[model samples]
Target chain A: MKLSCTIRKQQYQFSSVREVLGKASEEKSGDQMSQLSASSALERMAAKVVLSEMKLEDIYENPVIPYEKDEVTRIIYDDLNLTVYRDIQNWTVGELREYILSHTTGRPELSRISRGLTSEMISAVAKLMSSIDLVLASQKMRHQAYCNTVIGEPGRLAFRCQPNHPIDDPEGILASIKEGLSYGCGDAVIGINPNNDSVESVTRLLRMTHEFMQRWEIPTQNCVLAHITTQVQALRNGAPISLMFQSLAGSQRANEAFGVNKEILDEAMALMLRCGTASGPNVMYFETGQGSEVSLDSHEGVDMQTLESRTYGYCRHWKPFMVNNVSGFIGPETLYDGRQMIRADLEDLFMGKLHGLPMGIAPTYTNHMHADQNDQEIAGMLTALGGANFYMGVPGGDDVMLSYQDTSYHDDASLRELLGFRPLREFEKWLEKMGIMENGRLTERAGDLSIFD
Target chain B: MKQIDLDHLVQRVVEELSKKSQEAIPFPEEKELGVKNPHNREVLEQAMRRTPARIGIGRAGTRMKTTSYLQFRIDQAAAHDAVMKQIEPAWLAELGLPELYTRAKDMQEYLMNLDSGRFLSEESVRWLEQNGDKHKDVQIIISDGLSTSACEACIPDLLPSLLQGLALKNVSVAKPLFIHRGRVWVQDHVASIVRCKVVISLIGERPGLATAESLSAYMIYQPNESTVESDRTVISNIHRGGTPPIEAGAYLADLLADILRVQASGVAYAQLRVK
Candidate 1:
């Protein structure tokens, strides 16, 4: 009974650990499973237990819920972001920090809180905070923002590059990789969006990319953007599985497209915890866009931005490495253009950050979306100034396969120069070794094409 | 993501099956000729600001303004040019890309007979027999479909990314070829001649006043004689003004890889059950 209750508490965050534990204490007999199913609050949430119907299942296991897990989901999806953001609009860093901390029980140990403001609020706050007090805010945000790529600690800005190759072309891919590294790309991780949808193709690319990174002596990890099952299969097959990746949206039908559900996600999270490239438990990378829910047509009457926030809520369970908000990638039918994109980018960042996600801003744009690199760069700048946890290090800020322009190596350098942010720690060492970085600064020769030659 | 395409597929199926059947497909709801404003005056202005469409333009003494009239004339002229303009053969020659012509001999003939625009000429077939090599796993065909400007504008940025991405995948690619007057279905012809796994057709989209230089990439996994229309997929609205040319090229690399791996394209690939 205690184990089942604990599982229910973790899976169905609508109820608190206190509620589950409190109810568990009400049972006269320790093994009384009937008493466990009696609560109205739990009846709705009990379905989350995978073996709820299995009368003889081993429901009793680890009943100890971690401190961070306890508070990972609280006051989320309550239509609370705007009210809370409005309440704290004028509060100072210390005051706002204290209020947020007070709300979360797992303080000091866990760096992020799962419940908080929307990206809409964050972007507005970003613009408002851009000119006033960036250093202190960034410091606080950095402290609480996702993983610190330097080691696995929080504070330092994390980043990754996706050298989107056509389809398993080693020469072309290596050229792009060399070019990216020459320009000092690949801070958080170096991943590829494999064009092939087959699981075998993805596994091959993951293995190949991992070996390439290791051979190059680059500290960053690698991932192959493939279907969820393909990634899971690769994990079991002894293929180098970096952070497992997937494009997630709030709608059920959206995930159904990729054959994913909460069960699959939780299962993948479990598998990656065992085998993924690890500094710690966090080893998932999720890409999300605002318009995806509506784009999938399973919006369930929820607005796009709200649905996007719910994706983070679902993601927090895995304690992901980062959530890349693809604000402008969807196009005009959803967001229309640059102005809407800018707003959406801010909202995505704010919400993800609020939900305690290690948030990265891709600030992507496509020609079909009626926007360009310039528009994307502008959005990146705003989000960077807002202290987004990380940014994309794609080649030339262009993804050949995904068909969107994000932050390029030069763009990262410019952001660093303008924003005073540095790459993750290990990548910083590699940069210094290559003489691309000196005294934590990009040299004049930073993007010289001669490096590749 | 493949998921979006699948979800989009399901929704499209429902929409197609449910809509009242007719001999001709209607222009989309958004493509109606006149302005329809039911929102408040202030709200209408806000809506107009968000889109490029000419909306919220109040009547000028019950007649359109000179500025609006001039703008309409400009758009109409650009549309005319988009349809009539021919992609110079010299353009392809300078790029050192291989070139070909469809069976269609002229623009008027091409317009009148869609079938003529979708097949290669006898001489073109002979040329392919000599030059076709399976060294490249993917074949790219650049064509002037409905808007030549789109073809011209996208080539500079799109080609490098596509080639670079393909090279990264180490997927061998044959020398790119062009079509003087081609349609989306021409890819089947290219694939029939070239024994490659995939054929990508970068063709000009139907030009609109909003943007003339927009391109579309029509991809087929294994185009052959028995290929159905459902066996094709596309990434469209590509240009500096739509989906960036370079980005689209890179995206195609990944899509091609997917097509090759799954050995399927279009509706089948999207609906393919992932293991």
Candidate 2:
């Protein structure tokens, strides 16, 4: 594909990073070259960052945007032309390949983003592509992995209806489940985080969600994100265990919040494997993020990115169903803002996928956090483009109980429209039968329903 | 002959150390956590299971790790937002609430005059007196205190479940009401005028990042103008992210029943056990 800019007179095309490098080296380093070597025509232009020699500052405070509201942050957001999300989405395969390879590249005018477009971050994109001979080989491997697992397909995502029922009301629990599924969720796991961490509470939600699943004939697993002990109790009480779920962090303190350690996590995995009540391909689901260790005050001396990788190291021990990192959920203090969040989102997926986990993305944001729906959509687009195994599908990008906007049902629809991704095989069939989806496209009927009715 | 390349390695290390020395570098959240005492993890985790506080998180050199530091910041931000955040009146309809005000007219006035928010505006008092009975057995109110999301998130599940439980018990329950920009003390003002045996206000709590949707139920039996915070008993952290709103609602019903049976609440209610 050929990429051209409106303002610049230059037009050039090359298929490989080597070709771009050859062209780049021929020209003087400081010259304003509009078109380099590869693909497509763009109405807008984006400026890119010129990566300096490997400086120590780049590691910790390279793209230094603070969490506190300030002038720089205002400029970062207010700069309308710096459309990282839009620019990246429009970039060609050749552009992405060269962009990942070149450290000294600047963005097109509109591409002057704060974080994800950085050479430092795009290094992850490089790691993601195993080699030029077999492009998206990792994605194929990921698809194969999912096929082997219970989920059975990449991009066939799942979401838990974590309705904070202050009291474990079965009706309320069912409402959340129905609400999630009506919005085209429940492709992966239909789960609830029991508000009260009691065994009884766990069992009640299990029965409620299970009843909904059967009534609807939705092919899904039921999970409750309670403590492992509560899950164990639920198991002993003969409660069904489709996806044994927990929120895990690499640190002892972070995992301790969920009442888990490496040893305990292993034990729980063993216990889950033995739990007779099963439904899905894999038996476990885990949620993690960039700042979990920070939330628990556990990051020792390692950077957030490295610390996150270590957490993934812990998660891989399970080799279970899915591992999701709400890349931007930690707010801006550590991640700073949307730019940082985007970068972290890319890095986390790269690392998670590299570590041999069936990766999922939950693009989340809080009101006071560094991101919002716009930011989440950008991150979601990137993940969708990056070939994430799956992601959380929520209603209107809103998690009422969690008080954050995660990846929305609409986002899933949009991504599938853009990238041609679809949900699990069985759920897809169920959707077709429900007439919400036909062939591969979501019907107008899909968007019109209300669970309240 | 092989080149050692000690100079290159030393140069890189020196550069890293120099940058590190310029600014504080935090350790990873889980670095060397249980090296000295392996049991320390179990100890720390055991304590952590009980509360969401910074107890045993190891430090990075002389400073806190980036995780702990950010955690502190997020918590601080959450608390700050809880105090200063504004809730709009338009969404009250979603919760099946008709917005009512105290003496304080707006958020600024409410923040400035805590006592004013406790007392209903004259118009509101007149409306209440005109439409409602004075000697009610129990009055339930929902308020947006510190965290609006708390009430908005929890009350949907909490109120319905609670009302259902109370109804099943054949308990005398008044029409549910709301307090926009209301405080815990406001229950006393409504209770005194209504002459209720018990008043329960499911209000928002001081939120942390991890528990922004947490709600608190403050119950008082026969609360009057003289009622203080100590006179009210609270069942708190009621949200989907904490205690399930339905569970909190159900539990609140049991607690409110006890208060009604004993004709006492809070500290006194604890002393006078209800049948």
Best by the TM-score measure: 1
Candidate 1, residues A1-453, lDDT tens digits: the string is 222434434543324322332232211111121122225445433422322221111111211122233221231333334544454444433333334334342333223322334322222222222222332333334423222244224435556766665334554555456556655667667777775655677787787778877776787778877767668877888888767898887655566643566677889988887777765566788889876755444444434654576677667666788788886665454665677677677766665665666778888755444455557778878878767877877654445545445776657767776776767777888888877778767664454323433
**In lDDT terms, how accurate is model 2?**
0.57
Model 2: how large is the Cα RMSD against the reference?
26.0
Error of 1 at B62 (Å): 56
**DockQ of structure 1:** 0.02
The true-versus-predicted C-alpha distance at residue B46 of model 2, in Å, is 44
Candidate 1 positional error at B166, Å: 26
Q: Write the per-residue lDDT of candidate 2 for residues A266-336, one digit (tens) a residue.
A: 67767766773563346777888876655344443223554465566556566668788886664444454
DockQ for each model:
0.02, 0.02
- What is the Cα-based TM-score of model 1? 0.52
The lDDT leader among the candidates is: 1
lDDT tens digits, residue span B1-275, model 1: 69999999999998887774644743232312122232243444343333333333322322234455445445545554567777776776677777799999997666545567888999998999798775358889999877788878899889999999989998889888888888778778878888778888998866655567778888888776556544677666686545678888888898888788888887567657343
Which 10 successive residues of model 1 chain A have the least lDDT summed? A54-63
